[model samples]
Target: PTMEDFLQPGNKQVAAGYVIYGSSTMLVYTTGRGVYGFTLDPSIGEFCLSHLNIVTPPDGAIYSINEGNYNHFPEGVKKYIEYCKQEDKPTKRPYSARYIGSLVSDFHRNLLKGGIFMYPPTASAPKGKLRLIYECNPIAFLAEQAGGIATDGKNRILDIQPESLHQRVPLYVGSKNMVQKLQEFL
Candidate 1:
């Protein structure tokens, strides 16, 4: 895909993000002034700016994973999803459930509201879903430049030099606070 596919005229898009569901799934995006994510809030009937800056909290209260694919995930991922699920219990803060089945939608929420969007390597697709040059690279540039963090759950997305145009990689993005924590887990 090209840059023009995501950029719209007079749409007032401060930032843009999206998920490409292929053999796996990927989330890619960009921003105009500051990075902004598009969150689908049925209550609002539109994708609003749920997160302003990509500052991760020291202890992120929410986590997102494709539970339907749980059987195909790695132990690390299973463990993490377990932690998110635990929030539903009485002891936790009742971390909310938000899986729009759309990468842009999910990342938009995490970027704006402060959380993490993970697309780690699963058993089916070991390299992950997102393409570095066409997808992650652009979004990573926008996110980090706008006070957010973009990574492969371990290293900075911008630092990962690409050898091909469609190189794929796992992606972990959002507020720096949460991003740092997720990095530790990886």
Candidate 2:
């Protein structure tokens, strides 16, 4: 199959979701209305509604990213990382840094717990790394529907025009206020 088979903008999707396979298998999705989550019930062999109409908090005390790439990150992202590590209690500074190097895991945690998950442009990956259509789109859609925000540090994720099937993009998604604060740094 050619790359053209996968070239589609995120905004075209009417629904988007993801499944996490861990100690407890879970599915999360949205239909442009709201975000919902279900857990696989092993005994019943069915998905049971676990979270209904999930809503993300506007502010959080966690930041998820691959800090190993700190030296390679963009100037704005670098500053933002420093800001997350600052020692100001008034605004809940010095947020916890959690990075499992797993997009699904990181995004899922931030979605449920409230935080920012960023995959910004770096020296090695000037245009960013996560694919626009498959990787970023679904998560971006869920983020918005769950009362959060998803952006490329500037533009909305769903509004991005896909140039190729595997096009990579910078992604900054999470609670509304947290994402907006990162935008300020950008």
Candidate 3:
């Protein structure tokens, strides 16, 4: 197919989801309504209903980011990291930072558990790394449907126009308030 085929916006995406294979095989996905999970019942060899109508909270106790490149991140991101670790009692200070490096895995955990996952543009890669059409857009769609938000540190992830088939943009997606907090620093 031509590049035009991938020019569709995130809003136009029909569906997006993923499967997690660990102690149990579970399929999680969304169709713009809400997130849901189905577990594979090995005993019966069939998927069983597990999590349904999943809704992420406005704020969560977790924060996910690649701290290894902390020196390469922008000042805004650095401050946000500090904010997450603040010892404030009201906003749940010192939020747990979870970064496993796998986009799908880390994002899946944050999606279901409720938190922020940020992949800001570093010093070397100013455009960021995650592809817009395939990765950011689809996840942004699900984030919104699940009562969350997705952004590229500034604009809405779904609102960004695709300039290329494999466009990369900084990603920040998670609970509504958490995302907003991150944007404040941006």
Q: What is candidate 1's lDDT per residue for 1-186, written digit by digit as tens?
A: 775443322132345456545443434345655544445555656556554544434344555666788788767666666665564445354556577766666765565566667788887789888887666766666667557778886667877756665678888776676577556656
Order the candidates by lDDT, highest first. Answer: 2, 3, 1
* Top candidate by lDDT: 2
Q: What digit string (tens of lDDT, one per residue) describes model 3 on residues 121-165?
A: 998989998999989998888889889999998888999989998
- TM-score on alpha carbons, each prediction: 0.65, 0.95, 0.96
Model 2 per-residue lDDT tens digits across residues 1-186: 676556667888999999999899999999999999999999999999999999988898889999888899988888999999999989898999998889889989999999999999998898999999999999999999999999997799999989987889999999999999999989
Q: How many backbone clashes does candidate 2 have?
A: 0
Report how far residue 153 has shifted in candidate 3, in Å. 1.2
Off by over 4 Å in 3: none
Who is ahead in lDDT, 1 or 3?
A: 3
lDDT, residue 98, candidate 2: 92
24 Cα displacement, candidate 2 (Å): 0.9
- Model 2: residues with Cα > 4 Å off, grouped in runs: 1-6
